[model samples]
Target: MTEDTSWVGPAMQQRVPWVKAVGITFGDVTARRVVAHLPDDPQLHNHVGGPHAAMIFGLGETASGAVGLAAFGSVMDRATPLVVSSEIAYHRLARGPLTAVAELTRPAEEVLAELAGGQRPEFTVTVGISDTDARETTRMVVRWTLRPNR
Candidate 1:
């Protein structure tokens, strides 16, 4: 069955104002993965003129959220997805426009099955931030939880 992922865009737009403030733009979005881009703007640069660390991190996080919403959106009525934790590492200096690719680390069906059995389910999304040249500059793993509504 095709997944109704039409909610991804509006979810990102309405839920995360901070991402918009940073000028992050989303690309391909699916149940398993998401891609986003951040333009290299002087206002977003760090002292060394690269995208600031926080802006890069936000780009990755937003990509992860887009995929998460695509994967678990059907269950929104019974559960609310929340980011439980995240770990990120900056690997190199990022320059020019940057891209972030995020993918779900666990099968959506598996997580949904656990939730159906009356347990909160947690899953991870891994994101890679790369420069215009396609060299990875940061890596992030964000853990998300689908908490059952009380």
Candidate 2:
């Protein structure tokens, strides 16, 4: 199914208010990939003056949800998508603006087929966070499940 990801940012803002409250921005959202950004603000800085780890984690999680929505929007009538778990690791001290790129670990079509077979399909999205200089600063993996509606 083709999803118009242009609605991702706005929809996220409405459904997950914290994302917008934290000043996260979105770019190029597709079924398999979604990109999000977090501005470097003093209020969001950690002890060392870098973006706080929690904010960076939020950026990655939001990006994962964006891609998941893009991939599964058409099937929402029958299933409710939820995050099962997530793991994030900071690779370097993040400075300046940060960007997160999330991609599905498996093809959307395949996962959809599993749902069609009356199975609750679980998939993982891998997100890579980078600094303005294009240096990798963090990595995250979010596992999601599309629970069939009762």
Per-prediction TM-score: 0.94, 0.95
Q: Write the per-residue lDDT of candidate 2 for residues 1-150, one digit (tens) a residue.
A: 655779888888888889879988899999999999999899999999999899999999999999999989899899999999999999899999999999999999999999999899999999999987899999999999999999
Q: Write the per-residue lDDT of candidate 1 for residues 23-61, one digit (tens) a residue.
A: 777788889999889888899999998999989888988
Q: What local lDDT does model 2 show for residue 146?
A: 99
Cα error, residue 105 of model 1, in Å, equals 1.0
Q: Lowest summed-lDDT stretch of 10 residues in model 1?
A: 2-11
What is the Cα-based lDDT of residue 135 in candidate 2? 97
Go through the candidates in order and give each one's C-alpha lDDT.
0.90, 0.93
In candidate 1, list every pair of residues with a backbone clash: none
Number of clashes in model 1? 0
> Where in model 1 is the C-alpha error above 4 Å?
none
Q: How much does candidate 1 score in TM-score?
A: 0.94
lDDT of 2: 0.93
